[model samples]
Target: MINISYDIKEYRKQLFDIVNDGNVIVELGCHVGNTTKLILDKFDNVKIIAIDNSPEAVGKMEKLADDYSNLTFISGDVRRHEILLEAFRLTQSCDILSVDLGGGYHPDTVFKVFYIWSSTFKPVHSIIRNKGLVDFCNSAVVGCEDFKSHEGHLESYIDEGIPPQIKEFELWTPSLREK
Candidate 1:
């Protein structure tokens, strides 16, 4: 299992409140299942689908799933829309989508995956009502760069007159929250 330094309990609590009980949850780049374990412990009723491209990470995640039956691990890349589509097809709808792809210090891969996922999955206003949350724990400079990139991209989409698919978006740093 991955050893995370931050206090994940608060994020777990926020997720629980946003998703309630018996909702489907999807996690991208779930390395070693640390956050996945926290989610399962906090929201036992919800079904969790965790994906990681690395075999090593998937292996770690599989070990973490050994005792828990509610969690399912998928070994695939989130960059592939088909993979995400297939996963979403299996679950139909997800109440929460946690994106924690490995983009430490630099976010080229993270930006690509987030844009693809956001474009592919149209937020179903009735079923998946809550806005998706992204947790990025790294250097302040890197986080700020990601925030600016996301903000600019989102604005471009808005300027194109694209209907707001995402109800709301929350970008969080280790200590501060960026709108």
Candidate 2:
């Protein structure tokens, strides 16, 4: 969800907390490499496969990639086949899948993108930074005592992952028995 914090330290902590021992990280949006840079610097062993739709300045990403031997930056649209193919060719899987497409990331976009990334990589952990996600988080009432997270959530599914099926996506549905 959107790192809903005004303080920079709190936001950074929230983002970095999800990542501890993960070395190979697939970052969906590295618009400026700010977060990517932090990640690379934080973990000495971090290898970031960062992608961005923008290659704004000439040699911007190329320079960053050149500087960091551990980094592999791909420039393209995530929804495109070429991008997907390139990502697949780079690495079939990663330890973490970090998606921060943008601050105003719509839930629909997040769901669609995460569906593809999660299904493909099957990372040990995954995280999204989206403003809209905060709404869903706040709307919910549940345990906050750290139920096994990330891939661990898969075992407990609904209990840990919260609702994979959100109310926002529902308009009508087939019923085994009418409501």
Candidate 3:
């Protein structure tokens, strides 16, 4: 159970709840290994392949990974195609894909990478950050069911079912999922 005082604790708890034993999780932006530590403490038999661009962040994750043998930290920008490809090569597939890149200058870039990651790996679940990105993905990412964490809370979106492949038409136009 995530009992931390951080506002995102409940969100992390919700994410952890979906995780099962022996599951492989790919985390896009693991800053300081806070969430990674939580997941390690909670899941005993899970493998977490996490990536971060900053050396400082990767160092923190490295320290955390030393304690848990199940963690593998990659030091590189996850937004880069080469890095993402490397991540895919390392993990092969994932049960849950957790992305929280802290809303960079181009949110679209994050979505684009997510689209690529989702299409290639086809994760069973994805819990992404921010309202606008969540809104964008709901329509753009195929096989996405409109899921609200709680009533009137619009900061994130969680898809529990298996993801579908990207469509040709969605690549050309922007669409929002209608409630």
Candidate 4:
């Protein structure tokens, strides 16, 4: 969901290892079921609670969920707490949380969603795709705009107990869900 990706397949492939470790996955932004298919195809027993704001996207998810009884797709704006609560009503806990709001998601909004979801579910794994946060984190240039704008919050998150992890591939974010 980063701002740019030349090879979508390679960008999508980076998620293979991160999504490999969980059973109950809480996913945000199931656009056309690209990543959904990935998780479904990789594991037979995994249960996914997927959310999206677009009815079209949710419709696609519905079709994908046809063969998989384990998947629960909810059509709603994932940025809303109500939506989170609704999803939570279906499952008390989560094992993994994967978020891909696509390139249009603002960095701050993406981080806020991540923080809330991580706090709520405390998943064993979490992945996010955002160009802003990624740019902020990886930039080494002193006073780099991204770093200056996002470093404080990033550090604060770590101080508050969510240490950030850098991915080998910039298009994807991979983090170990902390206890």
Best by TM-score: 2
- Candidate with better TM-score, 1 vs 3: 3
Give me the overall lDDT of model 2: 0.65
Q: 55-126 in candidate 1: lDDT tens per residue?
A: 778678888778788888888877654576567566644556666665351354555455444433332211
Query: What residue runs in model 4 are displaced by over 4 Å at the alpha carbon?
Result: 1-11, 140-179
Q: Report the number of clashing residue pairs per model.
A: 0, 1, 0, 0
lDDT of 3: 0.63
Ranking by TM-score: 2, 4, 3, 1
lDDT of 3 by residue, 34-74 (tens): 88888888789999998888767866888888888999898
Write the residue-wise lDDT of candidate 2 on 22-113 in tens digits: 46788887787877778878887777888888767226776888888988988887765567667867776677777777757687777566
Candidate 4 lDDT over residue span 40-96, tens digit each: 988877889988888678678888888688888888877665686687678756766
Estimate the overall C-alpha local distance difference test score of candidate 4.
0.64
Give the RMSD in angstroms, all C-alphas superposed, for model 1: 11.2
Each prediction's whole-model lDDT (CA):
0.53, 0.65, 0.63, 0.64
* TM-score versus the correct structure, for each prediction: 0.57, 0.71, 0.68, 0.70
Q: Tell me the deviation in Å of residue 172 in model 3.
A: 17
The reply for model 3, stretches above 4 Å from the true place, is 1-7, 103-106, 134-179
